[model samples]
Target: MPKLRVVSYNVRGLKDDRAALGEVIRDLAPDVLFAQEAPRRFRWRHKCAELARSGGMLYASGGLPGLGNAILVSMRVTVEEAWGLRYPLTPGRHLRGAAFARCSVAKVPFLAVGTHLATDDTERPAQAALLAATIREAGGTTIFGGDINETEGGSAWRTLADTRTDAGATNQTPTFSVTNPSRRIDALFADKTCTVTSYSVIDTPAVRRASDHFPIYAEITL
Candidate 1:
């Protein structure tokens, strides 16, 4: 089995240090980057392209329609199919969504999804359920990553954990409030068919300045 390095990050809509963020991502050298809070306004694609280029990657999927969710892949991966999905809006609440891609690394295929759930306690569960269904429909080996906004054992977290392997189960490193770090809201989940070899919370200086949430990195095999 080949090992793939995957990272999930919330870039805070590129509102922070872009150069620092790129450097952190480049240094991490992930095969697949599942990003949330990416640029979604005017020239969003251009911004995303520039970020990907800076990190030695190419845009895979998700941007505007995903409401900030996006995915970037290294040269080693070929994106076979990709699309963005918008979750049903809860009037007056922020729009949340997900990005999905079927990619091949050295001709071995798998599904990757990125999302950011709503902050509302009541709304996040439904979003999680929707995300879980999307993963189930992804077929083959699947991996999902995002800023879930809820802690372990929470409803939204439990919804996904019930059917998938929580990548951070072995390493409960905190990933929120970069400076004061006190929670593990950012996470990665993979289908049982895939093996999560290692998982870590990237809390380096660059990562702390890149966004409000520390990135989660995982080494997986299918």
Candidate 2:
């Protein structure tokens, strides 16, 4: 089976150490990037395009209208279809959304989704439920990545993990507070049909300085 390298990152709206971020992403050479906190304000499309081009990739979808969630794909993958979705907004809370791409690498197809859930404890569970339903409807070997904003034993986490494999469930590497990490809030989940070959929390110096949260990487076979 062919392996697909995927990365999930929270770039903090590309507001910090963008150069280092670009370098780290380039070095990782991910086939697909599930980016959270992507630029969503003025000239967001231009910024997303520039970031993708700088990282030697093409803008696949998401961002702006997707409430800052975005996807970038390397040329090795062929995107069959792509779309963005906004979660129902909760009054007075941050707007959340997700991006979906049905893609193929070496002719093997899978559905990928990128998202960021609300930081509010009460809000996250509902959001996770909606996200899981969306994934169920996506159909195919499904892969999801995001800043879940909740950790192990949390309702939101459990909701998503109920049917999918949480890549970090056993490893439990912290991926937040880049300088002195102590939380495992970011993660990747995949359908059982997909094999999770390897997973890691990227913690190199460049990655630490790139954003408030470290990137999580995974290798999956379909």
Candidate 3:
């Protein structure tokens, strides 16, 4: 079995917090990384790709030119295909989307998703469903990491539980809002077919200082 290390981060780029994000990725050395809030700051600013390369990884991101998600993987992994999930305006912010990369690590196939959902109460459930649907469409039993901006006991959790083919909940940890640091807006969720051997919140302060949110990590085996 391959020891799959994954990370979910909301790097508040296109803003003041883009500086410290790269160091966090280097320190964690995750095999697969999913990032949100990758807004375009300039025409040539490839923050996501640059961060991935700095961490010795490859990256593919771009849905609506900017304001989407990104998936980064180490050189050891092979990415088959990747795309973004564009949600509707009712429950989505239109430009807000989830990015996916169908990848193989050590001969094991898994799908990675980078996502962000609307903060509105009614739209979040629909957005959650979209994520699960994306996972199912990817053939199930994959690793999902992102800044969901929802707590474990919220409606989004209930919605995900209903849509998931697997049996498990969020890590029940906190990851977000570094300025105050009290809620868990970031998370890692895996399919029922995957087994989570370990999980933790990364304490890379330099990384934390780069954005308003921190990163969540998990060690999964299948």
Candidate 4:
């Protein structure tokens, strides 16, 4: 069996202390990283690559096409396919989408999907539905990570939860507004194809200085 460490974080467009963000990422040391609000315009690719480099990982997929969602992988994983998806846009709302990569860790294959959803309560369900459908269709073991923009039990959260097991169910600690954390808006979900051995929230000085939301990750066996 192959076990992997998957991390999810909302980088706040890397507008904060990037070095601090890098430090947190380096410490967590993810095999697969799902980044939200990654640079979306103006040499976005370079910025995404730089982010991966800073974490000592490879830029696997996503960026502008994923509407700022991205996936970065450490050298241990071998990427086979990579792509992005954009959801139906609602007028006057920020664009929403997902990043996907089908990869193998120590020869065990799995899918990694990273995303961020709209903050508007009414807008998230549809996006969630699409995301759930895509995950179901993706097949095999999966590690889903993202900032859902709402806490658990919300419609969007439920939609996706119904489609997979919430890795954080056992320890639902908050991940937002790092300095004054109050919500668990970020998450990592694992499909039945794998087993989540542990879930964690990495909160440290670097995390607070890195972005508005703290980083969350899960260790799973496939």
Identify the candidate with maximal lDDT: 4
Q: Rate the local accuracy (lDDT) of all candidates.
A: 0.88, 0.88, 0.70, 0.91
> What's the TM-score of every candidate structure?
0.97, 0.96, 0.86, 0.97
User: Per-residue alpha-carbon lDDT of model 3 for 1-222, expressed as tens digits?
Assistant: 787878887877536444466667877888888777765445424665676776666785543432467787877778887777777776334457688878887888877777788777678888888777767777845777666667766787666655343212435445767776788767677766777877787766686577777777777885
What's the C-alpha lDDT at position 92 in model 4? 92
Best by TM-score: 4
Q: Worst ten-residue run, lDDT, model 3?
A: 163-172
Candidate 3 has which clashing residue pairs, if any? 166-192
Query: 50-114 in candidate 1: lDDT tens per residue?
Result: 88988888999988867899999998889999888888998999998999999888778899889
Candidate 4 per-residue lDDT over residues 1-222, each given as its tens digit: 988988999999999999999898899999999999998899999999999988888999999988999999999999999988899988898888999999998888999999999999999999999988987788777888999999998999998888577989988788888878899999898887678999999888888889999899889888
Ranking by TM-score: 4, 1, 2, 3
> Candidate 1 — what's its lDDT?
0.88
lDDT for residue 5 in candidate 1, whole number 0-100: 94
The lDDT of model 4 is 0.91
